[model samples]
Target: MLQGAGVVSLSGISTGAYATGIEPFRQVVTRYAIRPNPAAPWPAGLRLRIAVLTDIHACDPWMSLERIAGIVAATNALQADLVVLVGDFMVGQRYVTRIIPAAEWAPVLGGLAAPLGVHAVLGNHDWWEDPDALRRGGGPTASGTELTRNGIRVLSNEAVPLATRAGPVWLAGLEDQLALLPVRRRTGRGRLGLHDLAATLKAVPDGAPMILLAHEPDIFAQVPARVALTLSGHTHGGQVRLFGWSPVVPSRYPGRYAYGHVRERSDLVISGGLGLSIAPIRLGVPPEIVVVELGAEAVA
Candidate 1:
């Protein structure tokens, strides 16, 4: 009887783990309304709804093409003014998960719609596959042609002017710094400096509110106060958190910038992301579609 009881107890434990840890990948939308500091020079009374989707390792086992479609559908339903994809479209190396070609998933990504249009930056995985391929399109890079064909602009160390009701805001995108490293040497926590962040900022006209799209949140340190906000994803909220604490955060400053809104030199929002990496299970921290409402009081 004791042995039978132990089996039942073990089964319960497994069930609980699946419920708390792995089940959060169902894709929950987390909404936030951020009011730019009144003191800042942002255009007054201008409200911009920005939807952010990131870290979509659209491969098999965990993330499938259908899942990607569902995520896009949900984002579209949000009726955002601007939509930004922060990268990591493909799964990283050293994982045993099923591999899906980028072409198969590109059209689905192309389908994402927003009034201001869709913009993206390449993630480490996309860079790891082939940097050249990622830029010009083709190869296994998930974002290239598929995104461009669908009208999603891929920003690589460049800035574009977006006219908002408040005023003209500049959107700048940075290249994946981790792509500069040798694939075998990437530990996921290493510092990335390949992209010229300063140069990207310089392209933006002075006094215009700027929004930066970077894949990793660690770059928050370098952002100046002039840039109103920075959006990023890479840590995945440590992928697993226990009692609100993440045991492993793929970042240099795990304690401070692992997830959520962090204020350094400027305001930063680190999304937990919509897909998984390294493993198929997520605990405590759920997959998220971050809906950020700008020019309003901050709320979660």
Candidate 2:
């Protein structure tokens, strides 16, 4: 039996390192869509396929161009009307310039197309790699404006009205909580206040069914009562687990919210994410690209 509190040492670490440099690998992810049913008969017949992809951590080979391409292809096949990228789009510290480089795979992130439109928010990694630039400017100046040139819209603490068949679904994206942290610890730079929720909600009037795309699911507990659904994926489903238990997760949330599908009060669904965090190889927790079929009843 494996203890949940011991240090995990994988084979790759001996030959290489824990971070695993940067390489791309893909995993086809699946997830169930959840809704909050406050009253009788939540819209039963109406349905929508929402593709949720979180934690790309795209750093060239680490998160393969081929894999990202596969994700886009999968999303198209599912005919997902709405696509949500929760966060960790790119990763790198000093090599921020190379965070999202130009190569044959440069177009993967932006190739996604949905009738309801693709929605995304910045993750801790994205903010750490390149924050101010992805905000004021669309893309890095030196990179020849690649990400935006391809078509990915990075929303930071903002809201966009999505015209859905069922009236209008308001889509909101929050800035990285890691970005707002008090800068007191080893990883202090990425923390941010959860106040973005209130501001974004205020922007959307009353009675609009709103869906939020946040990199971290920690916000789920703090979201206003009216927000219908929230999608997140920063956990990476416990990237390398021994016998179904993950020893460590970087986030501050509870371990129950770490993997699979957890129904939190019927309004939250957090994907295990699609990429690796510190370790490139995954064990029990393979990467995923979630296809959530949203139905009338809340997923339980």
Candidate 3:
């Protein structure tokens, strides 16, 4: 399942146990360029750099504040114009309260510099926890009063127009497709749906190159065709994948869409993510911050 210079594969592991340990997970960081070609055409003169970090179950000590901070600092030094976080900000009940604590983690993450700023979306894990609480710390505030306080933008079923030197890039962040419930029954919620995605993307300016941040890559099946690229990272790239294969992958999507960059008619990039999930151990796929550059094709 290898495509071009990239590797594509499916996973068999579904549990959250194999995602522990700093040594194993630290290697998951990968870098790539997503420049536009004939098939994928962005604005000719506009070249934008995008950095992506996802599925960081920040509760794990391996992916400790120092490790996570280092990763963010490195990305900032790259001077990418935009930094995007996919999701799974927390690891359910385990690290619910400590997830991305602003007083600590934000100083490092918030220190990130990008002309367009940082943007993020919610994953099932975050939704399963206290979405209202997590939102209050980092990105968009639950009260919508601290949007600027944390220095990050959280997209949930909404589109924010980013003013770039080239003009404007319409960005949309979808609410976690997973179901939601009150505090007592948060994890008891049901599955998710893409019924709102189409309507959401349609709201964006037609013909404007659009990039979406959806925690789960499986949502691609229901997304509007106008979307150029969708960024995600819930699979941890098969956290404990052995020899490039995982015993199981916890994903709602069928087929090989559970991990990595799956190329359908459109483009999708899935980060292996920096932090751990259940057990906080990683094997093959390590944590990563992806770098993508967007532009037109080279002169032939």
| Predicted model with the maximum TM-score | 1
In candidate 3, what residue range of length 10 has the lowest lDDT sum? 7-16
For residues 113-190, write the lDDT of model 1, one tens digit per residue: 987889999888776666575343334355655677777898888999897766688899988767645533545444
lDDT of 3 by residue, 131-224 (tens): 6644332324332223235677777677888898877888888876653434325444443332258666866887787888888777787765
lDDT of 2: 0.64
Given candidate 1, what's the lDDT at residue 256? Answer: 86
lDDT of 2 by residue, 1-300 (tens): 254333244454542443344222436556675555453123336577788888776665565577678778887777788887787766533432234444343477678889987767766665454545434323242222454566666566778887767666678887667653433254544434433677877777677666777777777777766666678888776666667677876667757667665555546677767666665555556567787776644455
Residue 112: error of model 2 in Å?
0.6
Clashes of each: 2, 19, 16
Candidate 3 CA-lDDT value: 0.66
Model 3: how far residue 80 lies from native, Å:
0.8
The clash number for model 2 is 19
lDDT of 3 at 119: 86
Cα lDDT for residue 89, candidate 1? 86
- Candidate 1 lDDT score relative to the true structure: 0.81
Between prediction 2 and prediction 3, the one with superior lDDT is: 3
Of the two candidates 1 and 2, the one with more favorable TM-score, higher being better, is 1
**After superposition, which runs of candidate 3 have C-alpha atoms over 4 Å from their true positions?**
1-22, 25-28, 35-41, 92-103, 131-148, 179-195, 296-300
Error at 74, model 3, angstroms: 1.2
lDDT of each model, Cα atoms only?
0.81, 0.64, 0.66
